[model samples]
Target: MPDRNSAAHRAMAAAVARMPDPVSYQETALLETDLVAAFGTCRAVAVSSGTAAITTALAACGIGEGHEVLLPAVTVVMTVAAVAACGARPVFVDSAADGRGMDLNDLAAKTGPATRAVVAVHLAGRTDGIHDLAAYTRATGLRLIEDACQAQGTTSGGRQAGTIGDMGCFSLKDGKLLACGEGGYLLTDNTDLAARAAAYRTHWQSDAPDAPAGTHLGVNFRLAEPLAALARHHLTRFPEALAQRREQAAALHRAVDGTPGLEPITAAAGEEPNGYAALWRLTLPDPRAFAARLAQAGVPNSTGTHRLTAAHLHPACSRFASGDLPHARVTVDALLAVPFTEHDTDEAIHRRALTIRREAVRWTR
Candidate 1:
């Protein structure tokens, strides 16, 4: 068991070998359609990365300089950059105490006259009253953008994670269910939105080369044919990969039961994840201290995909977060992720992982 290869490492090697040469346009469409099909009633536009997907979606939605968007502080900086990249302002919202989803109470409090959209982050595959969050936008007349970069196959009430919003953005970075080392996609049911997004992917080239009006403020964010090919090869096997991940999450959840310093919240009722990122929202007395202990305890990994950059680290433009995001800060301080699914990860490695986490919980107290 000790000499066995990491399941993730092996899958990476195989996927690398499968990367297609001279990425194909036809294959690109196939991958895009498949992404949309999984989500139902939506069109998927595959892009270079989830960050690109979000930026393209935001831009196509007509958001621009001076526009404001509602987002959670508990996530990575890519979408924040996407929003900023499109010349919009990102208003950070604090997540709920449970650390599973956005804090709607905070979101309602933050909605303002200049708000253009509310971006619901399905953080760690945890949906925090996203339905209610979306409804709030419906009543307020603001657009809804779903950030599912970490949520590949998440479902809420028979609806896929990305399908439940006006537009959905996903990531296929090194660590995701739909991963091909690095890739991302945008999905939407709105035909016009899909058309706009598609145009943005290829440097805004309209079918007519001479038309100056073809691409409006677009960027070359297209996903490579080879990566899309990688996506095709793995998407076929995703169902099984997700199942394996879910099964492992169940085991880790059981093993950590009754641990106080570390609390692992389960999927909200009727919500199922594709097993991409298994989140542990921290409630430790001293999160930083606990994290250090956890690291020393041999916790194999960690993540900061959806979190705020230190004010000093952020671009001067981001220094002034358009909205308040206290809970966002809290979630960032406590979030933890573990490798959930890989082709042939040793079953024992899974147990060892659980044991390490349980020990960290003991140290938390």
Candidate 2:
């Protein structure tokens, strides 16, 4: 969340004051420009929320009824909801052995004739294994969409996480590294996809006077001007915020370096994480218990977000829901997450690290 005293708040205030109707105004266009420049993408389309971004991206890519879209099992329910919204079947892929990303082998085994696309979620802002996943999707002739909502500044194989796939989606919702209370954007080098997304976000309304009638269905997914203004202000400071998060994550990693049964889930080779959340693998029998203990010690932690449950378990995703995915279940059960913010001082992070180390030592004993 942006501080009340920060420039982001001021930007939002200015937008509110200047525009009585803040729907898809100049500020929103300017924010889209900033997003393209920041991420080095050819085009970006700002939308209402991350879920809307995902749905628009999928629809733009021509995924709809009867098409099977493969996405990781260890993701927020919204990802699955997006597929369902497109009238497509959501196919759940198991997590990798390390629990960091989708298992390519499992994805291959699940892909069938109906598979139209694959959504690679950069879980916890870590793009580990994404390059390989991209390669696999390309080889299999499947459209690749990166769900990079949590990966604002993450990179994999020398390319930005979101730009590696055919289309990437990002969330500017509060709590994300790049926040604007509630907004998101889609990125793609394909001009056709970009144009389709632009139309899809605005109820298929095109500005061209002689343009053909839109055949694709769409809804109102325009980003409000005030939110876009807030995002723009935060975008200017994102580099510094990313650096601070990395520093804080490193401090915590060092503190737990030698602790038994506790291991930091660092990025894989060729992947640079944005440090959105400090994650670790707890070898202890009960990671949820350790997370609870950390919370009691004044350190907020989680086994994963509540939305990390298997997609098939969610009532909203029952149309394509299947049996439990073993790897995703194991990964969720063993993973531990520690929250951090751009405003956290070094001393504050250090204190949290000390508490984590103390708790780890006590828990293992």
Candidate 3:
């Protein structure tokens, strides 16, 4: 999306102008260093993509072949692909009733001897019940991985999303809160795990002859210098950007506060959401039809659609047959995601809220 005169274009061009035979790792990668400071994590390991970050994190945690990693059924396919990439089986866990987090009971039921870790996805920047999930993982002795791809700037109980679990993965893909065109990074406080992930990111080499050999199998998942530079520039504007998004989302939530047949999805106790996306849980019947009505009223919604389908339903995960994810199925059917961003003006936010309220009331009657 960058044009010749755009700042991103210039930053990338400047980065390209400094290119040597190849981009050096870590030494000149200011982005990863900045991420560690920004996210308050002890270490950050940049990777080619968010999925690569997950795979690296899994490898760092020793989750490999014959291991079972539990993850929400309502997640992007790339999440499961990360597990499969490690030759580990992805055990699908049902979603919570609120549709913002995983169902604890379902997670308990699905966890078994093969379950070595749990991937708690903070869907849409909402981290409801993450504290409880973290406690559960600690009690059960399972490694916790927070797939905070959708929650880059979000937090729960005063802790950053990625820092709460054993390992946190973030996506810098376009459209994300902290995008870099295409990149990702893993964060963790565990010294050993951090070193393991750093090495895994680049064929497990220490960039020196006497450096440790690849402790875990890995690929060339290094974050390109241009992308890292772009990420660093974006970070400079993130605080202001986050504040603007929260303000707009708050205005919209207030407008629909008491609208019948519509309830705004909220953050859990002690959690500060990033307001990356606006979600509403329908209290009326026929959610798919309601979403259609909303679109007709000039407010398009991603509801009862394929965008948030159950991951088990995907062909790539065919090994895990469907029909057991009751909570996920129900939540997907009733929830709707309205388009939102920091760019929306106050007037636009109010108008979208009004459109939602008007259609919700009309459908209820």
Q: Which candidate leads the pack in TM-score?
A: 2
* Candidate 3 lDDT for residue 182: 96
What lDDT does each candidate get? Answer: 0.70, 0.81, 0.79
Candidate 1 segments exceeding 4 Å error:
1-24, 207-215, 279-284, 301-318, 322-325, 343-358, 361-365
TM-scores for every predicted model: 0.82, 0.87, 0.85
Candidate 2 has a TM-score of 0.87
- lDDT by residue for model 2 (1-365), tens: 67868999777645543433223479988988898899898999999999999999998888998899999888878898898899999999988877878888888999999999999887778876788888898899999999999888888878887999999999988878889899999988987888778877876664212222243357889998888989999999999988877777787787767777877787889888888878888888687677777777778665423434556665666667677788888787777777677677778888988887888788877
Error of 2 at 364 (Å): 3.1
- Please write out the lDDT profile of model 3 over residues 1-365, one tens digit for every residue: 68969999788656643434132454326776788889888878888899998999998888898999998887878899999999999988888776767889888988889999999887778777677788999999999998998887887888988899999999989867888799898988887887777766766554312234432355788888878888889999999878877776677788887888777777778888887778778878888777767777777566533355678776777796546787787777677776565567888888888888777777877
Q: Order the candidates by TM-score, highest first — what do you get? A: 2, 3, 1
Off by over 4 Å in 2: 1-24, 207-214, 304-307, 313-319
**Which sections of candidate 3 miss by over 4 Å?**
1-28, 97-100, 207-211, 214-216, 292-300, 304-306
User: Highest lDDT, which number?
Assistant: 2
TM-score between model 1 and native: 0.82
TM-score, model 3 to reference: 0.85
**Best of the two (1, 3) by lDDT:** 3
Descending-lDDT candidate ranking: 2, 3, 1
Superior candidate under TM-score, 1 versus 3 = 3
Instruction: Please write out the lDDT profile of model 1 over residues 1-365, one tens digit for every residue.
Output: 32228887566545543544222388788997787666676677888998888888887788889898888776566667788898888887777776656778887887887789988776666666778877888899888888888777778887888877788998988768778988898888887777677766665553213222232446778788888889988899888777877776666666665666566656788888765544565666666556555556555444332223422225653674654456555566666665454653556556645665676657655
